[model samples]
Target: MKAQFPIFDICKLSRCEQEDIFISRLAPFLDKHQNLLLSHKHTFYHIVLFTEGAGSHDIDFQRFLVRPYQIYFMGPGQVHSWSFEGKVDGYVVNFSTQFFQSLLLKADYLDQFPFFNGNVAEAVIDLSTNLHPLILDLFEKLVHESETVQHLRQDMVRVLLVQLFIQMDRLSFERPVHQATAYNYTLLRNYQKLVEKNYTSLKLPREYAELLFITPGHLNALCHEVLGQSAGEVIRDRIMLEAKRLLTNLSLTISEVAYQLNFADNSYFTKFFKKHTGLTPEKFRDGLFNQLSQDALSLQ
Candidate 1:
Protein backbone atom coordinates (compact mmCIF):
# COMPACT_ATOMS: atom_id res chain seq x y z
CA MET A 1 0.00 0.00 0.00
CA LYS A 2 1.11 3.55 -0.73
CA ALA A 3 1.71 6.03 2.04
CA GLN A 4 -1.21 7.98 3.45
CA PHE A 5 -1.34 11.78 3.41
CA PRO A 6 0.61 13.23 6.33
CA ILE A 7 -1.33 14.36 9.40
CA PHE A 8 0.94 15.80 12.07
CA ASP A 9 -0.02 16.11 15.71
CA ILE A 10 1.54 18.18 18.50
CA CYS A 11 3.14 15.15 20.11
CA LYS A 12 4.95 14.26 16.87
CA LEU A 13 6.16 17.80 16.18
CA SER A 14 7.01 18.99 19.67
CA ARG A 15 10.73 19.24 20.41
CA CYS A 16 10.18 20.29 23.99
CA GLU A 17 9.05 18.20 26.94
CA GLN A 18 5.57 19.71 26.62
CA GLU A 19 3.54 17.58 24.27
CA ASP A 20 0.55 19.91 24.20
CA ILE A 21 2.41 22.83 22.63
CA PHE A 22 5.45 23.56 20.47
CA ILE A 23 6.98 26.94 19.72
CA SER A 24 10.18 27.92 17.99
CA ARG A 25 11.83 30.17 15.45
CA LEU A 26 10.47 29.09 12.08
CA ALA A 27 13.80 28.66 10.25
CA PRO A 28 15.22 25.93 12.50
CA PHE A 29 11.82 24.30 12.67
CA LEU A 30 11.69 24.13 8.88
CA ASP A 31 15.31 22.96 8.68
CA LYS A 32 14.60 20.21 11.19
CA HIS A 33 11.47 19.04 9.35
CA GLN A 34 11.73 19.50 5.60
CA ASN A 35 8.77 17.19 5.08
CA LEU A 36 6.51 20.11 6.10
CA LEU A 37 7.15 21.57 2.64
CA LEU A 38 4.85 18.95 1.25
CA SER A 39 1.07 18.90 1.56
CA HIS A 40 -0.15 17.69 4.93
CA LYS A 41 -2.75 18.22 7.60
CA HIS A 42 -2.22 19.19 11.22
CA THR A 43 -4.15 17.76 14.15
CA PHE A 44 -3.37 20.91 16.15
CA TYR A 45 -3.91 24.62 15.74
CA HIS A 46 -1.03 25.95 13.62
CA ILE A 47 0.11 29.56 13.81
CA VAL A 48 2.97 31.25 11.98
CA LEU A 49 4.29 34.78 11.70
CA PHE A 50 6.76 35.52 8.93
CA THR A 51 9.22 38.26 9.80
CA GLU A 52 11.23 37.77 6.62
CA GLY A 53 10.50 35.42 3.76
CA ALA A 54 9.32 35.16 0.21
CA GLY A 55 7.16 32.16 -0.46
CA SER A 56 3.72 30.89 -1.29
CA HIS A 57 1.62 28.69 0.95
CA ASP A 58 -1.48 26.77 0.01
CA ILE A 59 -4.25 26.44 2.60
CA ASP A 60 -6.98 24.11 1.46
CA PHE A 61 -5.94 24.59 -2.21
CA GLN A 62 -6.00 28.42 -1.97
CA ARG A 63 -2.56 29.93 -2.49
CA PHE A 64 -1.35 33.05 -0.69
CA LEU A 65 1.90 34.95 -1.10
CA VAL A 66 4.13 35.28 1.95
CA ARG A 67 5.30 38.67 3.16
CA PRO A 68 7.14 40.16 6.12
CA TYR A 69 5.11 40.59 9.33
CA GLN A 70 2.35 38.51 7.81
CA ILE A 71 0.77 35.84 9.96
CA TYR A 72 -1.41 32.86 9.14
CA PHE A 73 -3.54 30.64 11.28
CA MET A 74 -4.80 27.13 10.64
CA GLY A 75 -7.33 25.12 12.56
CA PRO A 76 -6.85 21.39 12.73
CA GLY A 77 -7.49 19.19 9.69
CA GLN A 78 -6.80 21.87 7.04
CA VAL A 79 -4.48 20.76 4.22
CA HIS A 80 -1.53 23.10 3.59
CA SER A 81 1.91 23.16 1.96
CA TRP A 82 4.71 25.72 1.73
CA SER A 83 7.12 26.68 -1.05
CA PHE A 84 9.72 29.18 0.10
CA GLU A 85 11.96 31.25 -2.18
CA GLY A 86 14.65 32.20 0.32
CA LYS A 87 15.50 31.75 3.99
CA VAL A 88 12.34 31.90 6.06
CA ASP A 89 12.51 32.98 9.69
CA GLY A 90 9.92 34.01 12.20
CA TYR A 91 7.83 32.38 14.91
CA VAL A 92 5.77 29.20 14.79
CA VAL A 93 3.45 27.81 17.44
CA ASN A 94 1.58 24.50 17.32
CA PHE A 95 -0.74 23.55 20.11
CA SER A 96 -3.10 20.67 20.50
CA THR A 97 -6.87 21.25 20.29
CA GLN A 98 -7.15 20.77 24.05
CA PHE A 99 -4.45 23.35 24.73
CA PHE A 100 -7.07 26.01 25.46
CA GLN A 101 -10.00 23.86 26.47
CA SER A 102 -8.72 23.44 30.01
CA LEU A 103 -7.25 26.92 30.27
CA LEU A 104 -10.36 28.79 29.22
CA LEU A 105 -13.86 28.54 30.56
CA LYS A 106 -15.50 28.64 27.18
CA ALA A 107 -14.65 25.52 25.18
CA ASP A 108 -15.20 27.34 21.87
CA TYR A 109 -13.24 30.48 22.71
CA LEU A 110 -10.81 29.89 19.85
CA ASP A 111 -13.64 29.44 17.40
CA GLN A 112 -14.75 32.99 18.16
CA PHE A 113 -11.56 34.27 16.55
CA PRO A 114 -11.87 34.80 12.80
CA PHE A 115 -8.44 33.33 12.12
CA PHE A 116 -9.30 30.05 13.83
CA ASN A 117 -12.65 29.74 12.07
CA GLY A 118 -11.24 27.58 9.21
CA ASN A 119 -11.73 30.23 6.53
CA VAL A 120 -8.48 30.47 4.58
CA ALA A 121 -9.08 34.03 3.40
CA GLU A 122 -9.56 35.28 6.95
CA ALA A 123 -6.93 33.06 8.55
CA VAL A 124 -3.96 34.71 6.79
CA ILE A 125 -3.31 38.25 8.06
CA ASP A 126 -0.89 41.00 7.06
CA LEU A 127 0.05 43.43 9.82
CA SER A 128 0.73 47.07 9.13
CA THR A 129 4.14 48.63 9.79
CA ASN A 130 2.76 50.41 12.87
CA LEU A 131 1.61 47.09 14.36
CA HIS A 132 4.63 45.02 13.36
CA PRO A 133 6.83 45.92 16.32
CA LEU A 134 4.03 45.25 18.79
CA ILE A 135 3.18 41.89 17.24
CA LEU A 136 6.87 41.01 17.08
CA ASP A 137 7.26 41.69 20.76
CA LEU A 138 4.37 39.39 21.61
CA PHE A 139 5.86 36.59 19.53
CA GLU A 140 9.23 37.14 21.17
CA LYS A 141 7.64 36.80 24.55
CA LEU A 142 5.94 33.60 23.43
CA VAL A 143 9.29 32.22 22.21
CA HIS A 144 10.96 33.10 25.47
CA GLU A 145 8.15 31.61 27.48
CA SER A 146 8.36 28.40 25.52
CA GLU A 147 12.13 28.16 26.01
CA THR A 148 12.16 28.63 29.75
CA VAL A 149 10.63 26.67 32.64
CA GLN A 150 9.07 29.55 34.46
CA HIS A 151 6.11 29.72 36.83
CA LEU A 152 2.77 29.42 35.05
CA ARG A 153 4.66 28.98 31.80
CA GLN A 154 1.78 27.46 29.90
CA ASP A 155 -0.61 30.04 31.28
CA MET A 156 1.69 32.83 30.22
CA VAL A 157 1.91 31.37 26.73
CA ARG A 158 -1.84 31.18 26.53
CA VAL A 159 -2.15 34.80 27.64
CA LEU A 160 0.38 35.96 25.04
CA LEU A 161 -1.27 33.93 22.31
CA VAL A 162 -4.68 35.31 23.14
CA GLN A 163 -3.24 38.82 23.19
CA LEU A 164 -1.72 38.26 19.77
CA PHE A 165 -5.05 37.05 18.44
CA ILE A 166 -6.83 40.10 19.84
CA GLN A 167 -4.22 42.47 18.42
CA MET A 168 -4.68 41.03 14.96
CA ASP A 169 -8.44 41.10 15.35
CA ARG A 170 -8.29 44.79 16.28
CA LEU A 171 -6.70 45.71 12.95
CA SER A 172 -9.31 47.47 10.83
CA PHE A 173 -8.18 45.81 7.62
CA GLU A 174 -8.38 42.39 9.22
CA ARG A 175 -12.12 42.46 9.46
CA PRO A 176 -14.10 40.97 6.62
CA VAL A 177 -17.23 42.79 5.57
CA HIS A 178 -20.16 41.85 7.77
CA GLN A 179 -23.00 40.82 5.50
CA ALA A 180 -25.15 38.96 7.96
CA THR A 181 -27.16 40.36 10.81
CA ALA A 182 -26.25 39.06 14.27
CA TYR A 183 -29.10 36.57 14.29
CA ASN A 184 -28.46 35.45 10.74
CA TYR A 185 -24.74 35.16 11.46
CA THR A 186 -25.38 32.95 14.46
CA LEU A 187 -27.82 30.84 12.50
CA LEU A 188 -25.42 30.56 9.58
CA ARG A 189 -22.60 29.53 11.90
CA ASN A 190 -24.83 26.90 13.46
CA TYR A 191 -25.81 25.69 10.01
CA GLN A 192 -22.17 25.47 8.97
CA LYS A 193 -21.28 23.52 12.13
CA LEU A 194 -24.07 21.04 11.41
CA VAL A 195 -22.95 20.68 7.82
CA GLU A 196 -19.39 20.07 8.96
CA LYS A 197 -20.48 17.38 11.39
CA ASN A 198 -22.99 15.65 9.13
CA TYR A 199 -21.96 16.55 5.60
CA THR A 200 -20.93 13.03 4.68
CA SER A 201 -24.37 11.64 5.43
CA LEU A 202 -26.64 14.65 4.97
CA LYS A 203 -26.51 16.22 1.52
CA LEU A 204 -29.79 18.11 1.27
CA PRO A 205 -30.59 21.67 2.32
CA ARG A 206 -33.93 20.59 3.73
CA GLU A 207 -32.22 18.03 5.92
CA TYR A 208 -29.98 20.72 7.36
CA ALA A 209 -32.89 23.17 7.58
CA GLU A 210 -34.84 20.69 9.66
CA LEU A 211 -31.85 20.35 11.93
CA LEU A 212 -31.69 24.15 12.16
CA PHE A 213 -35.42 24.31 12.88
CA ILE A 214 -36.13 26.44 9.82
CA THR A 215 -37.67 25.92 6.40
CA PRO A 216 -35.49 25.03 3.44
CA GLY A 217 -36.41 28.34 1.75
CA HIS A 218 -35.27 30.25 4.83
CA LEU A 219 -32.00 28.35 4.90
CA ASN A 220 -31.40 29.00 1.19
CA ALA A 221 -32.13 32.69 1.60
CA LEU A 222 -29.81 33.00 4.59
CA CYS A 223 -26.93 31.26 2.82
CA HIS A 224 -27.36 33.43 -0.27
CA GLU A 225 -27.61 36.61 1.74
CA VAL A 226 -24.57 35.86 3.92
CA LEU A 227 -22.36 33.53 1.87
CA GLY A 228 -23.46 34.58 -1.62
CA GLN A 229 -24.14 30.93 -2.33
CA SER A 230 -27.12 28.65 -2.05
CA ALA A 231 -27.41 26.33 0.93
CA GLY A 232 -26.85 23.35 -1.34
CA GLU A 233 -23.73 24.95 -2.74
CA VAL A 234 -22.29 25.39 0.73
CA ILE A 235 -22.85 21.71 1.54
CA ARG A 236 -21.48 20.70 -1.84
CA ASP A 237 -18.34 22.75 -1.26
CA ARG A 238 -17.72 20.98 2.07
CA ILE A 239 -18.23 17.57 0.46
CA MET A 240 -15.95 18.47 -2.44
CA LEU A 241 -13.23 19.69 -0.05
CA GLU A 242 -13.29 16.37 1.83
CA ALA A 243 -13.10 14.47 -1.46
CA LYS A 244 -10.01 16.44 -2.44
CA ARG A 245 -8.38 15.83 0.94
CA LEU A 246 -9.04 12.10 0.70
CA LEU A 247 -7.74 11.98 -2.88
CA THR A 248 -4.38 13.26 -1.64
CA ASN A 249 -3.84 9.89 0.05
CA LEU A 250 -2.50 7.77 -2.81
CA SER A 251 -3.36 4.53 -1.04
CA LEU A 252 -7.10 5.13 -1.31
CA THR A 253 -8.71 3.87 -4.52
CA ILE A 254 -11.42 5.94 -6.19
CA SER A 255 -14.11 3.52 -5.08
CA GLU A 256 -12.81 3.55 -1.53
CA VAL A 257 -12.76 7.32 -1.49
CA ALA A 258 -16.30 7.42 -2.83
CA TYR A 259 -17.45 4.91 -0.25
CA GLN A 260 -15.90 6.84 2.61
CA LEU A 261 -17.58 10.01 1.38
CA ASN A 262 -20.96 8.21 1.28
CA PHE A 263 -21.31 8.66 -2.44
CA ALA A 264 -23.80 6.45 -4.28
CA ASP A 265 -21.13 4.75 -6.40
CA ASN A 266 -17.78 5.22 -8.08
CA SER A 267 -19.28 6.61 -11.32
CA TYR A 268 -21.42 9.15 -9.52
CA PHE A 269 -18.45 10.22 -7.38
CA THR A 270 -16.27 10.63 -10.45
CA LYS A 271 -18.91 12.78 -12.17
CA PHE A 272 -19.33 14.95 -9.06
CA PHE A 273 -15.58 15.43 -8.63
CA LYS A 274 -15.14 16.26 -12.32
CA LYS A 275 -18.11 18.62 -12.34
CA HIS A 276 -16.72 20.72 -9.49
CA THR A 277 -12.95 20.42 -10.03
CA GLY A 278 -12.87 19.86 -13.84
CA LEU A 279 -10.64 16.83 -13.25
CA THR A 280 -11.36 13.23 -12.45
CA PRO A 281 -10.10 11.85 -9.11
CA GLU A 282 -7.29 9.91 -10.77
CA LYS A 283 -6.19 12.93 -12.79
CA PHE A 284 -6.35 15.13 -9.74
CA ARG A 285 -4.17 12.75 -7.74
CA ASP A 286 -1.74 12.49 -10.64
CA GLY A 287 -1.50 16.27 -10.86
CA LEU A 288 -0.78 16.52 -7.14
CA PHE A 289 2.05 13.97 -7.45
CA ASN A 290 3.48 15.78 -10.50
CA GLN A 291 3.34 19.09 -8.70
CA LEU A 292 5.06 17.62 -5.66
CA SER A 293 7.76 16.17 -7.92
CA GLN A 294 8.33 19.53 -9.57
CA ASP A 295 8.47 21.25 -6.20
CA ALA A 296 11.04 18.74 -4.98
CA LEU A 297 13.15 19.31 -8.08
CA SER A 298 12.98 23.08 -7.66
CA LEU A 299 14.10 22.79 -4.05
CA GLN A 300 17.07 20.68 -5.15
Candidate 2:
Protein backbone atom coordinates (compact mmCIF):
# COMPACT_ATOMS: atom_id res chain seq x y z
CA MET A 1 0.00 0.00 0.00
CA LYS A 2 1.06 3.57 -0.42
CA ALA A 3 2.23 5.64 2.53
CA GLN A 4 -0.37 5.64 5.32
CA PHE A 5 -0.52 8.58 7.74
CA PRO A 6 2.99 9.84 7.03
CA ILE A 7 5.26 7.54 8.98
CA PHE A 8 7.57 9.81 11.01
CA ASP A 9 11.22 8.90 11.23
CA ILE A 10 12.50 9.06 14.80
CA CYS A 11 15.91 10.48 13.93
CA LYS A 12 14.46 13.13 11.64
CA LEU A 13 11.77 14.14 14.12
CA SER A 14 14.30 14.34 16.96
CA ARG A 15 16.86 16.13 14.76
CA CYS A 16 19.50 13.78 16.04
CA GLU A 17 21.54 11.37 13.97
CA GLN A 18 21.81 7.67 14.72
CA GLU A 19 19.70 8.04 17.84
CA ASP A 20 16.92 5.48 18.27
CA ILE A 21 15.71 6.85 21.60
CA PHE A 22 14.26 10.37 21.88
CA ILE A 23 13.21 11.88 25.22
CA SER A 24 12.07 15.36 26.13
CA ARG A 25 9.52 17.38 28.08
CA LEU A 26 5.96 17.18 26.79
CA ALA A 27 5.10 20.88 26.74
CA PRO A 28 8.18 21.95 24.81
CA PHE A 29 8.03 19.04 22.43
CA LEU A 30 4.39 19.80 21.69
CA ASP A 31 5.18 23.48 21.28
CA LYS A 32 7.93 22.81 18.75
CA HIS A 33 6.05 20.15 16.76
CA GLN A 34 2.42 21.09 17.16
CA ASN A 35 1.67 20.80 13.49
CA LEU A 36 2.77 17.18 13.21
CA LEU A 37 1.70 16.03 16.68
CA LEU A 38 -1.97 15.82 15.88
CA SER A 39 -3.51 13.05 13.72
CA HIS A 40 -0.38 11.21 12.56
CA LYS A 41 1.17 7.84 13.30
CA HIS A 42 4.72 7.34 14.46
CA THR A 43 7.15 4.62 13.45
CA PHE A 44 8.47 4.47 17.02
CA TYR A 45 7.05 3.54 20.40
CA HIS A 46 5.58 6.56 22.29
CA ILE A 47 5.62 6.79 26.07
CA VAL A 48 4.53 9.85 27.96
CA LEU A 49 4.60 10.00 31.72
CA PHE A 50 2.36 12.86 32.76
CA THR A 51 2.97 14.51 36.11
CA GLU A 52 0.42 17.27 35.65
CA GLY A 53 -2.12 17.45 32.85
CA ALA A 54 -5.80 17.42 32.17
CA GLY A 55 -6.49 16.38 28.65
CA SER A 56 -8.04 13.86 26.35
CA HIS A 57 -5.73 11.59 24.36
CA ASP A 58 -6.88 9.62 21.37
CA ILE A 59 -5.30 6.31 20.39
CA ASP A 60 -6.51 4.62 17.23
CA PHE A 61 -9.87 6.39 17.75
CA GLN A 62 -10.18 5.19 21.33
CA ARG A 63 -10.37 8.22 23.61
CA PHE A 64 -8.95 8.42 27.12
CA LEU A 65 -9.14 11.38 29.45
CA VAL A 66 -5.75 12.23 30.89
CA ARG A 67 -5.04 13.12 34.52
CA PRO A 68 -2.01 13.73 36.65
CA TYR A 69 0.31 10.86 37.60
CA GLN A 70 -0.83 8.88 34.62
CA ILE A 71 1.24 7.43 31.78
CA TYR A 72 0.19 6.82 28.20
CA PHE A 73 1.71 4.27 25.83
CA MET A 74 1.28 3.89 22.11
CA GLY A 75 2.98 1.22 20.03
CA PRO A 76 4.43 1.88 16.61
CA GLY A 77 1.90 2.68 13.88
CA GLN A 78 -0.84 3.64 16.34
CA VAL A 79 -2.35 7.06 15.60
CA HIS A 80 -2.67 9.43 18.59
CA SER A 81 -3.40 13.07 19.39
CA TRP A 82 -4.04 15.15 22.48
CA SER A 83 -6.21 18.12 23.44
CA PHE A 84 -5.57 19.70 26.78
CA GLU A 85 -7.04 22.55 28.78
CA GLY A 86 -3.89 23.49 30.68
CA LYS A 87 -0.16 23.05 30.49
CA VAL A 88 1.13 19.48 30.35
CA ASP A 89 4.12 18.70 32.50
CA GLY A 90 5.73 15.37 31.70
CA TYR A 91 8.44 13.51 29.87
CA VAL A 92 7.94 12.08 26.38
CA VAL A 93 9.98 9.05 25.33
CA ASN A 94 10.21 7.83 21.75
CA PHE A 95 12.21 4.74 20.90
CA SER A 96 12.43 2.60 17.82
CA THR A 97 12.27 -1.21 17.75
CA GLN A 98 15.95 -1.15 16.83
CA PHE A 99 16.73 0.19 20.28
CA PHE A 100 15.22 -2.92 21.85
CA GLN A 101 16.93 -5.32 19.44
CA SER A 102 20.29 -3.76 20.26
CA LEU A 103 19.91 -4.83 23.88
CA LEU A 104 17.97 -8.12 23.71
CA LEU A 105 17.98 -11.07 21.37
CA LYS A 106 14.28 -11.81 21.70
CA ALA A 107 12.03 -10.27 19.10
CA ASP A 108 9.06 -10.15 21.48
CA TYR A 109 10.75 -8.26 24.28
CA LEU A 110 8.50 -5.24 23.82
CA ASP A 111 5.38 -7.37 23.61
CA GLN A 112 5.79 -8.40 27.23
CA PHE A 113 4.31 -5.07 28.27
CA PRO A 114 0.51 -5.13 28.35
CA PHE A 115 0.24 -1.49 27.27
CA PHE A 116 1.90 -2.18 23.94
CA ASN A 117 -0.32 -5.16 23.11
CA GLY A 118 -2.17 -3.26 20.31
CA ASN A 119 -5.40 -4.21 21.97
CA VAL A 120 -7.47 -1.39 23.52
CA ALA A 121 -6.77 -2.43 27.08
CA GLU A 122 -4.50 -0.75 29.62
CA ALA A 123 -2.88 1.73 27.23
CA VAL A 124 -3.04 4.34 29.96
CA ILE A 125 -2.00 3.63 33.51
CA ASP A 126 -2.94 5.81 36.46
CA LEU A 127 0.02 5.76 38.74
CA SER A 128 -0.19 6.03 42.51
CA THR A 129 1.29 9.08 44.18
CA ASN A 130 3.83 6.90 45.96
CA LEU A 131 5.22 5.57 42.68
CA HIS A 132 5.42 8.99 41.02
CA PRO A 133 8.85 9.84 42.36
CA LEU A 134 10.36 6.56 41.21
CA ILE A 135 8.94 6.90 37.71
CA LEU A 136 10.05 10.55 37.48
CA ASP A 137 13.56 9.69 38.58
CA LEU A 138 13.88 7.01 35.91
CA PHE A 139 12.78 9.43 33.20
CA GLU A 140 15.15 12.16 34.41
CA LYS A 141 18.10 9.78 34.41
CA LEU A 142 17.26 8.66 30.88
CA VAL A 143 17.17 12.28 29.70
CA HIS A 144 20.53 13.04 31.30
CA GLU A 145 22.20 9.92 29.95
CA SER A 146 20.83 10.58 26.49
CA GLU A 147 22.44 14.04 26.41
CA THR A 148 25.79 13.05 27.93
CA VAL A 149 28.42 11.40 25.76
CA GLN A 150 29.85 8.61 27.80
CA HIS A 151 31.05 5.06 27.55
CA LEU A 152 28.15 2.69 26.83
CA ARG A 153 25.53 5.47 26.77
CA GLN A 154 23.34 3.43 24.50
CA ASP A 155 23.60 0.50 26.85
CA MET A 156 22.69 2.74 29.74
CA VAL A 157 19.61 4.08 27.92
CA ARG A 158 18.46 0.59 27.11
CA VAL A 159 18.87 -0.45 30.75
CA LEU A 160 16.84 2.51 31.92
CA LEU A 161 14.07 1.72 29.40
CA VAL A 162 13.95 -1.90 30.48
CA GLN A 163 13.66 -0.82 34.07
CA LEU A 164 10.79 1.53 33.24
CA PHE A 165 9.03 -1.21 31.29
CA ILE A 166 9.41 -3.63 34.18
CA GLN A 167 7.88 -1.20 36.60
CA MET A 168 4.95 -0.51 34.30
CA ASP A 169 4.35 -4.21 33.76
CA ARG A 170 4.25 -4.81 37.49
CA LEU A 171 1.66 -2.07 37.89
CA SER A 172 -0.36 -3.41 34.95
CA PHE A 173 -1.00 -6.69 36.72
CA GLU A 174 -2.09 -4.95 39.86
CA ARG A 175 -5.35 -4.21 38.07
CA PRO A 176 -7.42 -7.39 37.90
CA VAL A 177 -9.62 -6.13 35.08
CA HIS A 178 -6.62 -6.12 32.73
CA GLN A 179 -5.98 -9.83 33.18
CA ALA A 180 -6.87 -12.35 30.47
CA THR A 181 -6.47 -16.08 30.14
CA ALA A 182 -3.07 -16.85 28.70
CA TYR A 183 -4.47 -18.81 25.76
CA ASN A 184 -6.92 -16.12 24.69
CA TYR A 185 -4.42 -13.31 25.20
CA THR A 186 -1.86 -15.11 23.07
CA LEU A 187 -4.41 -15.67 20.32
CA LEU A 188 -5.44 -12.01 20.29
CA ARG A 189 -1.85 -10.81 20.41
CA ASN A 190 -0.88 -12.99 17.46
CA TYR A 191 -3.90 -11.82 15.48
CA GLN A 192 -3.07 -8.16 16.24
CA LYS A 193 0.52 -8.59 15.10
CA LEU A 194 -0.64 -10.19 11.87
CA VAL A 195 -3.12 -7.36 11.32
CA GLU A 196 -0.43 -4.76 11.95
CA LYS A 197 1.87 -6.35 9.37
CA ASN A 198 -0.66 -7.23 6.65
CA TYR A 199 -3.67 -4.96 7.11
CA THR A 200 -3.03 -3.28 3.79
CA SER A 201 -2.89 -6.44 1.67
CA LEU A 202 -5.08 -8.82 3.64
CA LYS A 203 -8.39 -7.13 4.37
CA LEU A 204 -10.56 -10.09 5.27
CA PRO A 205 -11.02 -11.58 8.73
CA ARG A 206 -10.99 -15.08 7.30
CA GLU A 207 -7.53 -14.46 5.87
CA TYR A 208 -6.21 -13.72 9.33
CA ALA A 209 -8.06 -16.72 10.76
CA GLU A 210 -6.55 -18.93 8.05
CA LEU A 211 -3.09 -17.59 8.80
CA LEU A 212 -3.64 -18.29 12.50
CA PHE A 213 -4.88 -21.80 11.74
CA ILE A 214 -8.28 -21.15 13.27
CA THR A 215 -11.82 -20.99 12.00
CA PRO A 216 -13.22 -17.53 11.31
CA GLY A 217 -16.09 -18.17 13.71
CA HIS A 218 -13.68 -19.19 16.45
CA LEU A 219 -11.61 -16.11 15.90
CA ASN A 220 -14.66 -13.91 16.14
CA ALA A 221 -15.70 -15.67 19.29
CA LEU A 222 -12.28 -15.14 20.83
CA CYS A 223 -12.30 -11.49 19.91
CA HIS A 224 -15.77 -10.90 21.36
CA GLU A 225 -14.81 -12.74 24.51
CA VAL A 226 -11.52 -10.92 25.02
CA LEU A 227 -11.97 -7.47 23.53
CA GLY A 228 -15.73 -6.85 23.52
CA GLN A 229 -15.60 -6.60 19.72
CA SER A 230 -15.88 -9.02 16.84
CA ALA A 231 -13.00 -10.21 14.69
CA GLY A 232 -14.44 -8.29 11.77
CA GLU A 233 -14.54 -5.08 13.79
CA VAL A 234 -10.86 -5.45 14.63
CA ILE A 235 -9.89 -5.91 10.97
CA ARG A 236 -12.18 -3.14 9.73
CA ASP A 237 -10.95 -0.79 12.42
CA ARG A 238 -7.38 -1.26 11.29
CA ILE A 239 -8.32 -0.48 7.71
CA MET A 240 -10.34 2.59 8.62
CA LEU A 241 -7.48 3.76 10.81
CA GLU A 242 -5.15 3.83 7.82
CA ALA A 243 -7.85 5.57 5.84
CA LYS A 244 -8.07 8.30 8.46
CA ARG A 245 -4.30 8.63 8.50
CA LEU A 246 -4.11 9.00 4.75
CA LEU A 247 -6.90 11.55 4.86
CA THR A 248 -4.86 13.66 7.27
CA ASN A 249 -2.29 14.27 4.53
CA LEU A 250 -3.77 17.13 2.52
CA SER A 251 -1.30 16.38 -0.30
CA LEU A 252 -3.18 13.20 -1.22
CA THR A 253 -6.49 13.54 -3.01
CA ILE A 254 -9.50 11.43 -2.11
CA SER A 255 -9.12 9.19 -5.14
CA GLU A 256 -5.45 8.71 -4.46
CA VAL A 257 -6.16 7.70 -0.89
CA ALA A 258 -8.72 5.18 -2.05
CA TYR A 259 -6.40 3.75 -4.69
CA GLN A 260 -3.52 3.45 -2.21
CA LEU A 261 -5.76 1.61 0.24
CA ASN A 262 -6.65 -0.85 -2.54
CA PHE A 263 -10.30 0.07 -2.59
CA ALA A 264 -12.03 -0.86 -5.84
CA ASP A 265 -12.99 2.79 -6.32
CA ASN A 266 -13.50 6.05 -4.49
CA SER A 267 -17.21 5.34 -4.02
CA TYR A 268 -16.54 2.07 -2.23
CA PHE A 269 -13.97 3.67 0.04
CA THR A 270 -16.34 6.50 0.92
CA LYS A 271 -19.12 4.03 1.65
CA PHE A 272 -16.88 1.89 3.83
CA PHE A 273 -15.46 4.87 5.70
CA LYS A 274 -18.89 6.41 6.24
CA LYS A 275 -20.35 3.12 7.44
CA HIS A 276 -17.65 2.87 10.13
CA THR A 277 -16.89 6.51 10.95
CA GLY A 278 -20.19 8.17 10.08
CA LEU A 279 -18.33 10.63 7.87
CA THR A 280 -17.25 10.64 4.25
CA PRO A 281 -13.58 11.14 3.45
CA GLU A 282 -14.16 14.65 2.22
CA LYS A 283 -16.17 15.54 5.30
CA PHE A 284 -13.57 14.07 7.63
CA ARG A 285 -10.75 15.96 5.96
CA ASP A 286 -12.76 19.15 6.04
CA GLY A 287 -13.55 18.69 9.72
CA LEU A 288 -9.89 18.10 10.53
CA PHE A 289 -8.83 21.27 8.72
CA ASN A 290 -11.54 23.28 10.41
CA GLN A 291 -10.47 22.02 13.81
CA LEU A 292 -6.82 22.77 13.10
CA SER A 293 -7.73 26.29 12.01
CA GLN A 294 -9.70 26.88 15.17
CA ASP A 295 -6.78 25.67 17.28
CA ALA A 296 -4.40 27.97 15.47
CA LEU A 297 -6.72 30.92 15.98
CA SER A 298 -6.97 30.10 19.67
CA LEU A 299 -3.21 30.28 19.92
CA GLN A 300 -3.30 33.72 18.32
Q: Which candidate number maximizes lDDT?
A: 1
lDDT for each of the candidates? 0.86, 0.82
Candidate 2, residues 65-104, lDDT tens digits: the string is 8898888888887777678878887888998878878669
TM-score for every candidate vs. truth? 0.91, 0.84
Q: After superposition, how far is residue 288 of candidate 2 from its true place, in Å?
A: 0.8
Show where candidate 2 strays beyond 4 Å.
1-14, 27-41, 117-121, 174-178
When summed lDDT is taken over every stretch of 10 residues in candidate 1, the lowest stretch is: 171-180
Q: Candidate 2, overall lDDT?
A: 0.82
Clashing pairs in 2: none
Which pairs, if any, clash in model 1?
none
